[model samples]
Target: MRLTRVTTAELDRLEFHAVRSGEHAKVAAQLLELANQVDAGSEISRAELFVRAGEQWEFTQEYERACAAYQRAIDDGAATVVDARALRAGALLHLDEIGQAYAEFERLEADEPSSLQTYLHVAESLYAHDDLAGAERWATEGARLFLDQVGDPYVDDLLQELLRIRFRIRADLGLAEDALDRCTDTD
Candidate 1:
């Protein structure tokens, strides 16, 4: 498929279906070739293509390539800055770059303090790294933020997840008394 002759919309459709149908590697290669053919001034389009390439790489379990693609997206100022950063942090964590991942999450949190997604990602990352205290702190903060700012019913779902994570952290840390107190408070 010589995508050079195709319109941007066609390329998008092809790439989307290709990735969705589990032809990530093939789609990524096609995207790379198509990217080279696009004008240099198309930074936004290029960034989006790179992000899609990163997603393909991630789906195929290629963490390094995914991270590189996400970084390229970041450099190009892709529209999905939050998503790209989050995926990059996740890729870094998968690569065992714990410190770097933590830094990325922290930077994202600072940049988007009101974002529930950022809070959840930070808390989950901390939990994965066995930082129960940090996880609990972030989860609690997120729950409070959700309660104070978002009156949506969806906030309850998030609160439930946070509560579950907090309970797990408390149990893992041997804080049975605290856990019992939490249960009582909930009741």
Candidate 2:
């Protein structure tokens, strides 16, 4: 297989399908080989491959390995990429590095204040860290942002899912009124 011409986006899609088909180990090795094929100074490729490897390790429950891959991505200038920070933040969260994850998300939020996934992640992480108020605020922000910006009817299903989770989390935190209002609005 001529892997040299493969793009990072292609590798990412391949990795996803590989995981879905339970070829995690195969995907991991392929990602590592991809990393090796890139020159050390090829920061963009390095970051992307490392993130792929990290996600594979995460799926395999190799948290430490995942963390290392994410670290390599960072070391390879992931900070310069479009969604690198989000990927890094998600990796940190998966590794249970809550504080670091929070910092990364906060930084991303500051820069891209209306990103739905970022807000969703921040809310979920905050809820995990037992910050109900913070979680509620983030979830609310995420839901509103999604409604305002994401207009594809194809995304309606996901939006409904987000609404469900938001209400459930809010209700869990005793924000029943707010949850009810949001639910009605979504309907």
Candidate 3:
């Protein structure tokens, strides 16, 4: 479908699922090429093209190229706040700019409190840096937010992961009793 008539968010959703399932790389090249297509001398489409290319590069772990593409999108001002921040954060994380990635996630969380993914990323980064206490806090907050407020489609997956992380954090902090209590059934 032509981009002008098609919703960008819808296309982005499709691309997200494709990348998640590892099937979008080939289609991604085509999307990237189309991103540069200009209609009636407008640069809008070109900006979107770069953003999509950046997203594809990110999915493939080409961190530097992904960041460049995302930077182009920002310079073009075609990316929405949520998309831009998320992509930039992912690229920064891939590049091992953990502090920058954490800051990005913090900004995203402030704007979107229901963004479990950002919380999860923050927690994972903190954990990687051996900040178990901070990671535990983030993981607990994410689990509670998802389970209580959103009940999102990813709840089960997030919950399982949270459980694991919580256990690890507790164990590492020498709270084995607390950790075991959580892991066991209360019924």
C-alpha TM-scores of all predictions = 0.61, 0.66, 0.56
Cα lDDT over the full model 3: 0.65
lDDT digits (tens) for residues 1-187 of candidate 3: 4543335674677687776788656656666656555453443456666677776776787788777777776677654422556567667877888888768767766766455555665676577667788778777776666665434546656566666776677678787555433642233
Q: Candidate 1, which segments miss by more than 4 Å at Cα?
A: 1-21, 26-53, 78-83, 176-187
Cα error, residue 58 of model 3, in Å, equals: 3.4
Candidate 3 clashing pairs, residues 3+ apart or interchain? 35-49
Could you tell me which residue pairs clash in candidate 2?
none
Cα deviation at 146, candidate 2, in Å, is: 2.7
Give stretches of model 3 more than 4 Å off.
Answer: 1-27, 33-55, 68-87, 129-131, 149-153, 176-187
lDDT agreement with native, every candidate: 0.70, 0.66, 0.65
RMSD of each: 5.9, 4.7, 6.2
Lowest lDDT sum, 10 consecutive residues, model 2, at 78-87
Tell me the number of clashing residue pairs for each predicted model.
Answer: 0, 0, 1
Which has the greatest TM-score? 2
